[model samples]
Target: MNDEILVPLDLSDAIAMIDRQKEQIAALTTENERLRKEIKEIKEKIKLTNEYVDKYHGLGDRSLEDARKVEREIALSQSETQWLNR
Candidate 1:
């Protein structure tokens, strides 16, 4: 009957183990919230950068400013008048 012995679990050891696991779970929850906020900020920054690129770098006529311009007067010369000649 010595080989077939029964034992009872100590309640204090089980309570200590549960308390440690609860602390670990609380730490993990706080770390998860921090990571979530960090990801949100990163996504917002990426969105702002994309908006800036689209506003300033997309399909704009930046080369037209380099073309040269000249000022000149246009005149029309008439050698004869139609009513006087007729």
Candidate 2:
């Protein structure tokens, strides 16, 4: 045996539901924009780090390991941010 219950929503309830959905969309949009900005910033950091690494490597600098560590951290942060956006 199967039983189903159907509930009807009035005008006010429908309006409220729509309003809630709108608020959720707005919040999500804001979050998406923020994540995009964060990703952009991370990319910039990566570019700068790579440039610094390249410059130092050319000069046979000793802080290469530290720069690599920083690069890895930045990459990890970027991956996390991308996962969050998804």
User: Which candidate number would show the highest lDDT if scored against the true structure?
Assistant: 2
Root-mean-square deviation of candidate 1: 29.3
Candidate 1 per-residue C-alpha lDDT over 1-85 given as tens digits, one digit per residue, 9 for 90 to 100: 5433322245666787999999999999998997687567556655755565555564456422221110011011111222332
List clashing residue pairs in candidate 1.
none
Predictions: Cα RMSD each: 29.3, 7.2
Which whole-number lDDT from 0 to 100 does residue 14 have in model 2? Answer: 85
Residue 4 in candidate 2, Cα distance off native in Å:
22
The models' CA-based lDDT, in order, is 0.51, 0.79
Please report, as a residue range, the 10-residue window in candidate 2 with the lowest summed lDDT.
Answer: 1-10
User: What are the per-residue Cα lDDT tens digits for candidate 2 across 1-86?
Assistant: 12222233455678899999999999999999997888789779978897878777754546677697887888797799779868
- For model 2, state the Cα shift of residue 10 in Å: 1.9
